[model samples]
Target: MQNLEEAELCFPQLLNISCKKHIRPQAEAMFIYIVLSSISLLTVALNLLVIISISHFRQLHTPTNLFILSLAVSDFLVGLLVMPFQILLTEPCWLLGDLVCALYYLLNFITLCASVFNMVLISVDRYVAICDPLHYPTKITAKRVQVCVFLCWGYSVFYSVMFLYDNLKQPGKYNSCYGECVINIIGPADLVLGFIIPISAITILYVRVFVVAVSQARAMRSHIISVTMKHSSTVTAKKSELKAARTLGIVVAVFLMCYCPYYCVSLSLVIGSSTEALMIFVAFFNSCLNPVIYALFYPWFRKSVKLIVTLEILQPHSCEANIL
Candidate 1:
């Protein structure tokens, strides 16, 4: 009985060759399951709302929103495909075998990379709109945004495949025992490509955005008493830009907070420990966090959700309805 408890083979029939179960307390496992499951469901539901809202509403069909739509689609996939597999990974046994595990991590990487790319696109959109408003409309057309989205997804697939090439070539290559699943990351490469480059782009762009926004806000304040301020085209444009920068800045800030820890850890060393699982999941949890931020800050998202939930969108000409 003591040996059985101590060994706790993931596959008892295999005995010596089976992996030992790394079982937590039953209560702790149960809580983790419930939390992760809830996150999965919420992530799916909220991202679907964003997708439907943007796709079905004509008013929401702008360049900035195109980036958001792309992000929603990626988050939707994370919920639909990645999160469930992640939940299974938490289990003591690898019931589905090595190929599925490889697929799970692949899907995970693709969605996350796509999301980061979308964010970069969004920041660029905002940057152009605020910093270079005259050329913004011409520069950020729907076709261009669509092409960028496609490229982002394509790059994500290529990157993920290359990153996990060995594991894809030989499933179970890293497993020391049957019923165990493990994959190691090349920390230095991950830190450079995944963490440093993308994060640097996002940070630099947002910093420029912040500087412009703050300067514009001060200009508005200084001219507040002038009646002409309201009618000034420059003033009006600056106000709009400031508001947009503020909203999207909140989103980018939250993204940094959620993504930082995992990549920060990746910078120092390898990530095959038990604690790495928690860090990865924490980063994955950002998939759900974004839509909640949208719901809180975006009146259009709130209105669209109401319209969708109440089935008002089924009415003919509903897409023509004003969402903004």
Candidate 2:
């Protein structure tokens, strides 16, 4: 009876090689499951709302909104596909086979990379719009943004496949026992390709953006000092540019806050235990927070959500309604 009770193997029939399940307290596990599941559901719902709002409203079809739409799509997939599986990972045993596990992480990387790329595109869009307002319309058109979004997803797919080639080719390569799902890709490659390079690019772009924004602010102040009616239209355009820079700046800041800790740990090669789990979910939780950021900062997003919820979007010609 003692030996039978001590045998806590994930696969009872293959007890010799099977992974031992570290059974957490039932109540604790249940609570964790509930919380993570709720987060996943909320993430899916919020991002879906963002997706529906931007995609359905013709008035929201501007170049900037197109970037938002692409971002929401990536976050939506994170919620829909990635979060559920992530929940499974938190568990003690991996009932889903090794190939599925590899594929799950692969999808995870793709969605995350796509989100990062979308943010980069957004930063570039804002840079041009704010710093070079005259050429913005010509440079950052709807068609061009669409092409960029497609390429972002395509690149993400290729990168993820390339990074996880070994794991995909030979599933369970890292698992020492049955019913364990773990992939240990080298840190240096991920550190550079996933974190350092992209982060450096974003940092440089934002620095340039900030310098231009400060100069624009000074110029606007000078124009106000002159107090000329002829400069009224120019003042309004400058105000719009400053407002855009501020809003997107918040978006970038929030993204960095969420992602930085996880990457820092990865770069340091100190990932383990509950701290690692917390860091990962902290990053994942950013997906849920992004749409909320839009709601708070973007009046158009709030208006569009109202239209979507009230079934007003179903009305003919509703897409033409002035959301801005």
Candidate 3:
């Protein structure tokens, strides 16, 4: 009995103060690890492709693609850094020391904030494109998008520092035993700054976008009936309709499906033992889904993927190749 008890302790040498390791069946543990690892790899690969596709292709250097590149970079970091550490979080004990754990969560918060802000930028981009197409070119320039991306990341860093300042000042302050790693951001601050405000903004913007989209759709149908087929402006209107449809699908799925449940559960402060991990995984899974959505909906993404895989991207003047 003593042997079994010692085996269950995360640090057997520490005796009473050591955290008790939660052992699972070997097969179950292996299955869970395999699944999570696969997701981590997939997330990393997909986001990397997006980063490469946008960065390398000159034709993709528009304001919208620049926003996507920023989003991809954050998601890439999440997969590369955050998701792997999350796997560690699922382990019976944190093998890494308290300071590393603190820093890990710090990075996680920064990336999460960056992703949220990037989404906000994306929403704004789509809003202008759909609702005010005539002025979009002047209003949403590449220079402005680049500035927004820079500010988004800078704010994320500052916000995360403020959020984790206490924990950083006293690492392991919340740990009750050796071999454990846990820290909590202030609940009210997290709820307000991290969840409530951003979500509200995204919701309001999307609602306005939806309302405009409906009105425009009706207008387009009536215009098509009055206009002749030879009008090239009708083609431009049809293209805008398709872009709006794709943007709507991506925005709704990403915000509602991936982010909403996690924040709701977190803010509710009623994380079920069985559901907490699943909720977190769902949130991280969104990073991977974004690129896949692009691949499915954007032909340029498919073409870029093909070029990248075939190593044609290395050919002379490949960057200038007509992807559009």
Candidate 4:
């Protein structure tokens, strides 16, 4: 019963209210959101600390550390650049103009793609190191690491541009709620490109890496047993190899834990009409969980924490010596 001009004026406000009502829960949903947000913030802070410590400390600049540094940087950026906007813009209407919304979406896609690809590269690097230790030096040199990092950024930018181009061409297809950026449910293309392909590739790489690592561990144990025929020495080397294998396994496990649910939620959005807002929140939570996983499993991070604690305990004595 309204004219076109009146309808246009009223539409955005209506959409905004709808978005807020949907996100503002009675009780349970708010609790979940708060808990997840807390976890995410904590994870981001931890990753930031880890990255800063590794970068500032000269002793922690090995190849393995370099890969970890890359991972931490990606996680930190996701936490900083993507999650906060997503959490704040949960209302049905976007307060930031269209330009800002578009830019945020673009950056979100780019950083996520970069993170996933970096995981794949890390897995491949681990595979090479475990499967062929001698050739690993030639295959995964510092130069190669730099090249891989460069390619990750380049590929992320290229694909992100393509995605943005496609998205901008059909802006009307998306539901522009304040809190949600629900793209039109395109065919399998979105699902495949956004979630399935990257997850599958990473999963495959990790599976192969696991198989190779287990075989290597067994072979190394057998070799040690045969060489000195001393159980104690064999046990020590076995423990070292086991520790290394466990570290790699934890990395893969963390990747699966933090990302698999996100991919599932994304696929569900593409394939069905479910709660897009909830799914987006879940995916955001994954970005925050990565740092917790690192803290639990990463040996270098654990060592760094201990070193920090020790230095703090020794600080007073060092200060007194300097004064004297």
The top-ranked prediction according to lDDT is 2
Error of 4 at 147 (Å): 1.9
- Report model 1's TM-score to 2 decimal places: 0.94
lDDT rank order: 2, 1, 3, 4
lDDT digits (tens) for residues 1-324 of candidate 3: 999999999999998999999988999989989999999999999999999999999999988889889999999999999999998888898989999999998999999899888888887887787778778889999899989999999999999999899899999998989988888778778878887788777778777777887787787677776777688675576565547556645754575688778877877786535477788899999888888888877889899999999999999999998987
Return the clash pairs for model 3, or none: none
Instruction: Tell how far residue 310 is off in model 4, in angstroms.
Output: 8.0
lDDT of each: 0.86, 0.88, 0.85, 0.64
> Which order, best to worst by TM-score?
2, 3, 1, 4
Q: Which is better, 2 or 4, measured by TM-score?
A: 2
What is candidate 4's lDDT per residue for 263-321, written digit by digit as tens? 67656654323455556665556556656665676665666666555674245443222
- In candidate 4, which residue pairs clash? 19-92, 90-179, 91-179, 92-178, 93-178
The model with the greatest TM-score is 2
lDDT comparing candidate 2 with the true structure: 0.88
Off by over 4 Å in 1: 1-7, 227-234
Give per-model TM-scores.
Answer: 0.94, 0.95, 0.94, 0.75
Q: What digit string (tens of lDDT, one per residue) describes model 1 on residues 1-324?
A: 957754798877777788888888999999989999999999999999999999999999988888999998998998888988888888888889999888888888889889888888889988998788889989999999999999999999998899988988888899999997777667688668876798789899999988887887787788778838447877776676677778888888888888888886766564666676788788878889888988987889999999999999999999999877
lDDT-wise, the better of 1 and 4 is: 1
TM-score of 3: 0.94
